[model samples]
Target: MAVQQNKKSRSKRDMRRSHDALTGPTLSVDATSGEKHRRHHVTADGFYRGKKVIDTGSNE
Candidate 1:
């Protein structure tokens, strides 16, 4: 018996890699043009990168 750890131990590592390749990078859209963009680090000023951050109340 043995225990596996992390991504290397997972047999689905290749699948994960493949998905990442297929999607390339995560980028938000303008909902108008199909152009791509990236998001910078989130700030505590209720803004993510440069866009306004919508705070959805907890559903708990």
Candidate 2:
């Protein structure tokens, strides 16, 4: 079996993992409801891209 000949340095290891940090979901405002929702996702009221895609059947 083969193994690493030298141990990786902390700075190099951290640099490689820089993009591994957790990031919050990107959100955008609904053009009509003015509500915040994740990009490419429907709002709580079932709105997508400023139009109704699903019928939540809510009185609001």
Candidate 3:
């Protein structure tokens, strides 16, 4: 019988996701595209500040 492997176990793409191709703090994904949405890319200073607040549920 064939075995199923975890996706992350497979070779990861050397290319950074287009989403991370920008300056931001957290990354979100498009609801449908299944692509990484480059949003909230901010500097550590701004991130800690009120630049953008509220719990995004991200480990931050």
Candidate 4:
């Protein structure tokens, strides 16, 4: 078993854990569709920045 020879300082520990906190992805609502989607990402319907670029086939 490995043992710690020295204690980790508070500042060092905090800095290391700074990115450990869970955070929800930043999302923005589409003005046209009124749907919430992540920034810089296309909506489920394949729309990006208010433009329909992809053809999401209908699930008929």
Q: Best TM-score goes to which candidate?
A: 2
Each model's lDDT comes to 0.51, 0.92, 0.45, 0.92
> What is the alpha-carbon RMSD of candidate 2 to the true structure?
3.1
The segments of candidate 4 whose C-alpha lies over 4 angstroms from its true place after superposition are 9-15, 58-60
Q: Identify the candidate with maximal lDDT.
A: 2
lDDT of 2 by residue, 1-60 (tens): 989999999999999999999989998989999999999988999999888999999668
lDDT of 1 by residue, 1-60 (tens): 877665374556776676665445566643333334554533333455455575545545
Better of 1 and 3 by TM-score: 3
What shift in Å separates residue 45 of candidate 2 from its native position after superposition? Answer: 0.6
lDDT of 1: 0.51
- Candidate 1 stretches greater than 4 Å from native: 1-23, 31-35, 41-60
Give lDDT tens digits, candidate 4, residues 1-60.
Answer: 999999999999999999999988999998779999999999998889889988889766
Model 2, residue 33: C-alpha shift (Å):
0.5
Q: Give all TM-scores, in the order shown.
A: 0.20, 0.76, 0.23, 0.66
Best-to-worst TM-score order: 2, 4, 3, 1
In model 4, pairs of residues that clash are none
Error of 3 at 17 (Å): 30
